[model samples]
Target: MPLDGQLSTLNRVYKDKDAQDVLEHALNNFGDMALVSSFGAESVVLLHMAAQINPDVPVLFIDTEMLFAETLEYQRDVAAQLGLTDVRAIRAKRETLFEKDNENLLHLHDTDACCALRKTEPLQRALQGFDGWVSGRKRVQGGDRQALEYFEIERPLGRLPRAKVNPLAHWDRDDLQDYIKAHNLPRHPLVAKGYPSVGCSPCTTKVKTGEDARAGRWRDQSKTECGIHFGANGAVRAS
Candidate 1:
């Protein structure tokens, strides 16, 4: 289906409820769907929701290997706490990394290439076999994602045509925090240390008081996205 058609379908079906309701409905309708979570600040809410509705729902975690130890620990802890049975940690192939950039200087000289190798490619491989995948992205994050929709037609993986569901696309940071608190969910420890958005340890840092939530990521660069969510033609759909 065309992207516009997919978006229209989602908007029509999920227009009545908030983003969370849309997410729950997606999981309920598509039994084989998976949620791709970074286990960042407010990730606990979605993880908890999925576990409550279906503990068996697959939760794909892209462990870039360069991520902070805290993130890995939190991923395991949160999954265990929520009783999420299908959490899979995806990683870049060692051979691919060695062959493409022997010095591992990809992120230093060319961040786009580095993200492709470490994040995009691995996630593409991990998403295979699923009819659709869910993301924790929200529109309020702004930048290239300000106009994000609830659903998008992602590139097909293997022989399967896949959909990317952004259930929280229209939510703001405050909503995320409220959900987490209302549910009494655990938070990523670094969030209290001023890191609103977390990514690879080498590229992430703590943000200032009034800085954008995403400012901590790729601090020295102008890059906002890692390119996996963009079209093959390099156009970024909102969220």
Candidate 2:
């Protein structure tokens, strides 16, 4: 499908639909689709909704090897609790890390490079078989995401462009909180400790009072994302 045509169809069909409706459209339309989850704060809401729609949908979770142990545990717990049948753990190649970042201090000199290696590369490889994938990003997170849409397009490095579905693009914190509480979904352990957004341990810090929800990630740096969702400029053009 042409880019504008796809966008037109998506906007027309899902402009007023909810997150669950968006997931249903993606799952029904795409032969190969997966749900990418960080199992981070508020991640459970999407996971729970996906499980309700189809527990067998593949759920991709990237393990950067630098993530907190609690995240790993939470990944397991959430999948088990939701009865998610296909929770795939995507990881960076050991050899690549050994050769390029044996000291494990890449983030200090170059934050973008570290994320590209630990995150973007691995996810691209894992997604080769899928035509579209789901994300939990929302407009309320701010920054470049303030105008997020229900469905966008992404072209990962050296891979074919694919549809990126953000089911919760229109959802907010209170919507997520209420859904989780109503469904009794399990929360990521670190959220209670002040980490509104969780990622690799060394780079993630707690968001201070009155700070942006994502302010803690790469705390001192200008980097707002881990280079997985969008390009360096935080723009994903239609494919």
Q: Pick the candidate with the highest TM-score.
A: 2
Tens-digit lDDT track of model 1 for 1-239: 66458657878878667776888877877546889998988788778877887899888898877888999999999999999998888889999989988786778888778888888889888877777888887789887577777877666334444677888888787888888888888889999999989988988999999998888888867787876675645524223
The local lDDT score (0 to 100) that residue 131 gets in candidate 2 is 89
> Using Cα atoms with residue i matched to residue i, what is each candidate's TM-score against the true structure?
0.91, 0.94
- Give me the runs in candidate 1 sitting further than 4 Å from their true place: 1-7, 156-161, 235-239
Report lDDT per candidate. Answer: 0.81, 0.86
Predicted structure 2, TM vs. truth: 0.94
Candidate 2: C-alpha RMSD to true structure equals 2.6
Candidate 2 yields a Cα-based lDDT of: 0.86
Residue 145: error of model 2 in Å? 0.7
**Model 1 residue pairs with clashes:** 148-238
